[model samples]
Target: MSSKCIVYGYMFLNVKMSSLLKRALFNNSQSIRKTAALFCNATRNHWNYQYQPGPYPKTPEERAAAAKKYGMTVEEYTPYPEDMGYGDYPKLPDIGEDSKDPHYPYDNPELKRNFNEPLHATAEIFGGDRCDISIRRRFSLLHQWTWFLGTLGGFALLMVFLEDYKIGRPVTAKQIPGQGVHYLFSPN
Candidate 1:
């Protein structure tokens, strides 16, 4: 009789737990669907390119209408230069010989001498023997060691505060009920 009663009690608890779990799952699924719909709508509305018609205007009136709609003044459209096809290639500026530097004379004897010398020898003309300078450390070794120790101590303290020690283990009298020293080393 006691065994039958125990079985019936377990069956009732199972049905109740299953109903609660089903309700929770159904509510979570509905909330997720709502969140997804909101995100999709937000993404669609955020970018102007998603709603824009086309790259170029279909007709001459369409271009004028767009400019007028935006409250911008319309400039007269001029045909591209005859030499340039579709205006893809830009016209190169005509750089004349007069644009050369007057300080660095092309015909000067000193300029010719320096030009013929090896690249390594040219570095002597400047103050340094090497072209590139060595990088100096900003902080001293003592400062770096202090920073490392400080960061290590901070992380250790944070770990001690954040984690719960008595999650899976049985409670102890010396553990002070709620507060206990959670050591990093676990026996198991």
Candidate 2:
């Protein structure tokens, strides 16, 4: 009897543990699979593109010829300066020069603005209606034509409805025109 009870308890525990494991897997299956695939693709790209460097040039002459082909001079072969062309501008004065130099006027705020004032900002600020004569004339003609066509259409519809018979009114059993075939052929 004791052996029988032990076997039954073992079976019960096994069933309960398996059901809990299955429920957890059902909830997290998609996320686990997606993370695995992303890791594999990232590993593949790293191995394919970034790991390998090309064969090296074996001789000094070959290296120098390749450098000159790409416009690097012999002086630039070593560790290059970060500010290679920082002071190439013609207008910038030498760093240790005196402020009395003529080119130093560009560095002064009042002198720079007075010498090179922008054109548009100095003119009067006009509101939205301000425009050239040609634009105003074109828009005036366009507005007149649009108003005339809209009024003509409204008058034509009013005259049609004023007729003794409502030609274009929605049809009802009493208001429908007499039954007659208008045409038997296609409209075109």
Candidate 3:
């Protein structure tokens, strides 16, 4: 085959391989992957897991064993709370922090944080403050009516303007002297 044809064939094979790789990576069906998994744990975060939930073994007999199995103990492990929904779970601790958020440098005040300075750092400062629009509406009653009437009036005027022009065959006909008289409409 020509050099061009050989290059085209290679390109086609590469495309096919890439597509197959993509299908294997991002396929909707997870049964094959789940079955293929040798072991499922919180660390791997597979769809099917058979992990022992906690009150974390933060200080296990072998801390390394806990670290290897659970990953950072309370620091990073996301317990399988699926059993909690079914009311068959252990008394899990108040779990919230995932350690993913950037640590605030308390020591260095000069360095501005890359994150936006939150409106309320510790608590919802504006939680108690409420504005009830029903009691006192933002727009006055007069203003509301004026706005509604203006839009409606403008629409009505445009409709009347459309009615001003009449487009159809003329009701009366002009006569050609040589030809017979013509009527645009037959007598009723």
Candidate 4:
């Protein structure tokens, strides 16, 4: 046979073998089999099969008849009441500024003293004690150094393990017998 004919023959065999393998693997897969079975069961008694197509029913009598023929019940449609014009609503009464009683139970007595005070004003202005606030050192230098060293050591150990672990080189179809023309399409 010519080289071109031999190449074509090998390509055809490779395609046929790949198709067979795919079919075998698909049939053997549990997820694929379950999914196909679920799809079949869901479509077995579909609405299109249960109901026949007919002209649209305009009147209530025709709709009722269609519903009965299709083994379904029909209910009369009712619309909600139309909203009244916006002007019809009653005007709200104005609250007097002199009202002494609190509008809500959770109102704080301190808030009533200065309702216009800016939020960033000193706490002492709100009757709080004038205490000096300073930042204290939470962690020592040695503790920080130990934490950094531990993280560095862990990363170094990980690098050492990764360096020692050797990955096998990928094998091409040409390296294996009877696997001609396969690696061109799939190297794995």
Model 4 worst lDDT run, 10 consecutive residues:
86-95
- Residue-wise lDDT of candidate 4 within 36-107, one digit each (tens)? 798878567746633333445557786667556544456532111224322111221222222324454423
Which residue pairs overlap in candidate 4's backbone?
A: none
Q: How many clashing residue pairs, candidate 4?
A: 0
The estimated TM-scores of all candidates read 0.19, 0.17, 0.21, 0.20
CA lDDT scores, all candidates in order: 0.51, 0.47, 0.49, 0.52
Off by over 4 Å in 3: 1-40, 46-149, 161-175, 179-188
- Against the hidden true structure, what lDDT does model 1 obtain? 0.51
The TM-score, computed over Cα atoms with residue i paired to residue i, of candidate 1 is: 0.19
Candidate 3 similarity to native, TM-score: 0.21
Runs in model 1 lying further than 4 Å from the true structure: 1-23, 26-55, 76-188
What tens-digit string does per-residue lDDT give for candidate 3 at 1-188? 79999999999999999998788777855854775674653566646444432343334444445444433443443333443442212232332122113365633333322342221221232222332222445789999999999999999998999897878987777556667655368586
* Best-performing candidate as measured by TM-score: 3
Total colliding residue pairs, candidate 3? 0
Q: Of the candidates shown, which would achieve the greatest lDDT relative to the real structure?
A: 4
Q: Which tens-of-lDDT digit does each residue in 1-188 have in candidate 2?
A: 69999999999999999998788679888876786798876565634542222223346664455345434454443321224431111112112112223444453543222342221211232212343222224357779999999899989998888876655767667554468865469788
Positional deviation of residue 35's Cα in model 2 after best superposition, in angstroms: 3.9
**How high is the lDDT of residue 73 in model 2?**
51
Q: Write the per-residue lDDT of candidate 1 for residues 106-174, one digit (tens) a residue.
A: 454333323322222223443233222332347987999999999999999989997875457666666
